[model samples]
Target: MPISYTDQQIREKAASLGLIQEGADLPRQLRGKVVAAMAYGDAAERHQAPEPQLAGEIVIHGSSILIDGEHFPWLVAAQPMDIGLNPDGVSTVRLTLMAASVQVIRPEPRPESEH
Candidate 1:
């Protein structure tokens, strides 16, 4: 069975992953940030091969994340579910999206001048 997490738990998890501030708006914080996404394959092909990394700016429309003009459903109501670390030792979180379980790498912060 899939584990269900509360909103507070989600927030805490995101914060711990450095994906959000203690009380910041998740969608707002992630909007326009550049990210690299890896969409996990189906159960049958999951362990067979890895998906290519897609890099693009985050665009939140309703409950979806738009990257390179493609719309990816965002699960957890625009919040990313903490999925722990990857084999490369990089921290990761599952967007819990549609059939595609997207793992978004930490977004690079823009320069102070851009803020």
Candidate 2:
């Protein structure tokens, strides 16, 4: 099975592929706003090889987006999910970016009995 890549690895690969340039961050137009991108594949393709779910939250500021949820302020953020490789070997994903600050807050703990 192909190994999954770390956030850093993915970032580097993206840069190498020219999807992103060195030291370039998410577009400023996407800052503080949420946008979504989606891709679709045929059912037969899924039967041949299943894909893993890729979803996460991120923060974006200026020209940078944090990979994982970290304490890095002033960085732009974009979350890409439902990643898949097309027949042409082109990887696709549904990406969303926040136009402004995006806060990912943990759900509040409820009473044990509530579970």
Candidate 3:
């Protein structure tokens, strides 16, 4: 069964994943961040796999936002509708704005020495 999540739940999950700052309330906060929107089931499986999948980049055009070149309303993108788990068992929220499930992800933060 698909897992359902409230906006608060999704925000908590995204914060935990470091995809967004805790308490972020704007879509612009995620602007330019790399995200993957895939089929819900496929996303679940891919999250457990070793290789990562690249979908589209997020482009915020003033009052609007676009992912993979398709338009996504600010309200829908800001409020994720579902949640899933990544390989490490951490929760990843899913946005239903696209025909595919949306997974907002970022690479693990490297230590300052690596920079």
Candidate 4:
């Protein structure tokens, strides 16, 4: 059986994975940043607890995403689609987005003698 997830649950998972921002239009954002799309599945149990693992190469360019899979015709139909991970080991989807604005503060440089 497929695992059921609410919209909030899905959004929370995406946020934790760094796939989407808190209030951003996830689907629209993903579409804007897609270079390619593909269907994915797991080698392990199909109905496992966690989502399926994606075993492939996915390159994330500036607001562009690329996915490569053997059976991914749905991707072609979707053109620009939002990507998310399933916690049932059913399939895998990759995503790419614009260079986000997450700043990292660095300490100011000090003179060698100050050490």
TM-score to true structure, per model: 0.24, 0.20, 0.24, 0.24
Cα RMSD of all models vs. native, in order, equals 22.2, 24.8, 22.3, 22.1
Provide the global lDDT of candidate 4 against the true structure. 0.49
Tens digit per residue, CA lDDT, model 3, 18-106: 77789985264553232322235457886785776454455555546576688865465445345464556545445645345567699
Clash number for every model? Answer: 0, 19, 0, 10
Model 2 residue 60 distance off true place after TM-score fit, in angstroms: 67
- Best model number under lDDT: 3
Error of 1 at 24 (Å): 71
Higher-scoring candidate on TM-score, 2 or 3: 3
Give lDDT tens digits, candidate 2, residues 11-112. Answer: 554466566677666454532221211111233455674566443544444445453566544422444455575566545544554456558889899999
Q: Is candidate 3 or candidate 4 better by lDDT?
A: 3
Clashes of 3: 0
Model 4: how far is 96 from its true place, Å?
55
Ranking by lDDT: 3, 1, 4, 2
Q: Which runs of model 2 end up more than 4 angstroms from their true locations? A: 26-115
Q: What is the lDDT of residue 7 in candidate 4?
A: 59
